[model samples]
Target chain A: MKLINKRNFISIVCIFFTLITCGKLLYERALNFTDRYYTDNIFTILGFSVLITLILSLHFYLQKFPFWLVIIAQYALTVGIVFLAIFIHGRFSTNAPTAYWDMFVSITIPFLIGALVYYICFFVQIKRANKVLEKLNSEE
Target chain B: MKLIKTREENLEENYLELHYDKIDEETNAVLDRLRDTLRYIEGTYEDKKVTIALTDIFYIETVDRKTFAYTKDMSVEIKEALKDILEEYSKIGFVRISKSVIVNIFKIKKLQGDINMRVIIFLKNDEKLIMNRSYKNDFYKRLNDLKGRSAK
Candidate 1:
């Protein structure tokens, strides 16, 4: 976000909100996924912050790629991340959920929603900018 | 600022020229506008020399240190560095997007930005360019100027 700049006040605000949001998700996961809850710590907070930042930075870089490529890459990346987490926790059991595609659905749907929100916000920003440009043009 | 008037009548053409002891920022900006309006940078294409009107260019980009100008139907390699070309055409409409790219705001069809960090600038030719976050402000400022002029 443009909030992450040299200005201390704005950067701090951005970081504060980021931590709050990520921390809330982690807390919810800890309540639901007990086995994975043990790994939560300061390192976990730091890790989540870094991971979220990297994923969001893709929005800026993804413009260089085609729409379809971005979709495939994002899908692969999300699945890869979930697999990595499972490996780290040593959860290798072949459950019924795997057969039913539970893990895949859980990981992919949120990412799709994220992509949707991103485009909606993008359209809103463009509309606002065009409106301002129109107002400026209408002036002397 | 000083204004000097001359009464020399020209039979062939009439024009204004600036003779300044030192070129300040404002004076240099005015000079850039005058030069870009009348100047046509030469390029080589298909083993032939082609002169490009600065305003007609949609964008100029450098790939592997070679600069090419993109118009509607022509892609001509110009004998100029990207930075130099930007300076020469800056007053007309071009603004740098990335390290190796500069685009003319007048040629842009639409602009959209995402939270993902990249802004999409659609050209009149339907080609899209990624607007780096670093150069977004300058691009919009130039766009505003272009819009104002079109309205007038």
Candidate 2:
């Protein structure tokens, strides 16, 4: 079995912390506007968690083709989650005004954060690879 | 360039660091042989200067009465015939896929073999060469040899 190195371990810890923080933030925001929305759909919550897990897993796997595919998949998943949020929020509350705008903001924020994180990780890997190439060239 | 030093453990054998400019076997062999051949020719053909690099070569062809080596930069009239050059560089992955032409295997990007019994080779520099049916066996054997060596 391969042991967890310092970098990978730190990355995993940060990802888990971010997921937890994001989930709590979503829950708090949903609760604050409970009169305007229904934030207690178990299936939607589970789907969101699975989507985040898949993104994190893809980020770690680090293959070039799959990384790009995963980014596209993440965007598709964000769209699905947005639709689910609107559906659930509408189903639970009848007299509430159109909370679709709230759903859009909630989905867009996480989507942007996910994209930023993915690109940051991708750029770092590219920098690391270029450094290795440069080192090989210099040694020659 | 930043240098990294890390302690690595081995299970059975002592570690030895192998160093080179690039890792691909075909490329390294082609570059090394090209350099050696250029150096050798420098002494023999002092009046006619020839500079051959991996990138300079376009497609080597035989037309009319002489074998001509075409490059993006310049063309060279080799004293050695097509057969002689092919035999000499066979070890360096040159395969005679047709009667009048021997191509640098490293320069080839893809090979398309069709039911019409013709093999079309797409080279890295976007030139295409047709391989005649007569030399198919020899071409296949050379390709297999290269693949076996590279696998190891």
Candidate 3:
């Protein structure tokens, strides 16, 4: 199947980037960090989000490819990008390698949860579609 | 053209026979329509050739230059090329939903909108196929025509 058009993809990426940046701002504010580089954090978040979006969109072109291959490639890229971003952020902030590991764990745990939620939702959609198919076939 | 009706008491099955002096566009159209009326297509199941009824197919898909017709419980390899099969069966209900797939519209129970302008067609067999953007217009037009005809 064809992918989302370029225009729509761009719009969606921009909207999500904005939301993520806002979320980051709120998270840091709630933690009450004494020293905050708002502009630098926004830029880092922007770069990370854009990279993740690009990685995820690669699946659109790989529609004919094996599903497992696509999912594995995307998941690998996402994890790698998240780890690299956190590592770099930690290096610039505190120069502590241990902090980077902690940050990575914090980020990846939520990402894994999100992936699990996605699979659950996908399963539900298929189940509902099957039910509708049965109903329609019965009517026929 | 003249129409003729013949009654034969010993005939086993009804058949249409055409006698023409020359083949033209109109004659080709009639022949095409007649071909589409055929009920079965040749397929290979377990290395043995079989005739699969058109109504039994959920969808036909081309993969790596080979074509397969999927039914509720089995998938049979069709010898005919995807385009040729579609050409012969499109008049009945076969519609190209993507570059490599032709779905029997009658087997589609419902269509759901998918992200990225694609459509998910749920079939009677609890299978789903994606209708690509490039073929969306033609597929929808054919569906509308089918609906119109059935309403009459």
lDDT, each prediction: 0.67, 0.56, 0.70
- The docking quality of candidate 2, as DockQ, is 0.01
lDDT of 3 at B24: 87
| Model 1, span A22-44: residue lDDT tens | 65567668887543433443343
TM-score of 1: 0.52
True contacts kept of 2: 0.00
Backbone clashes per model, in order?
A: 4, 0, 0
**Candidate 2: docking tier:** incorrect
B24-139 per-residue lDDT for model 3 (tens digits) = 89789767755665678888989998888787888999999999999888799988888898777787878998889999887988777643334688787888888764576577
Q: Which has the higher DockQ value, candidate number 1 or candidate number 3?
A: 1
Off by over 4 Å in 1: A1-46, A55-63, A90-113, A128-140, B1-32, B35-38, B44-52, B61-77, B96-101, B109-152
lDDT tens string, model 3, A1-140? 33445656776567657877666667768997643456755665567566656776676677555445666677777777767766676667664446456446544654566567856664555455445445535544
TM-score of B-chain for each predicted structure, in order: 0.70, 0.64, 0.74
Interface RMSD of each: 5.6, 17.6, 7.6
Q: What share of the true interface contacts does candidate 1 keep?
A: 0.12
**Top-TM-score structure, candidate number:** 3
True-vs-predicted CA distance for residue A15, candidate 2, Å: 67
After superposition on all C-alphas, the RMSD of every candidate to the true structure, in Å, is: 8.0, 17.8, 9.0
RMSD of candidate 2 to the true fold? 17.8
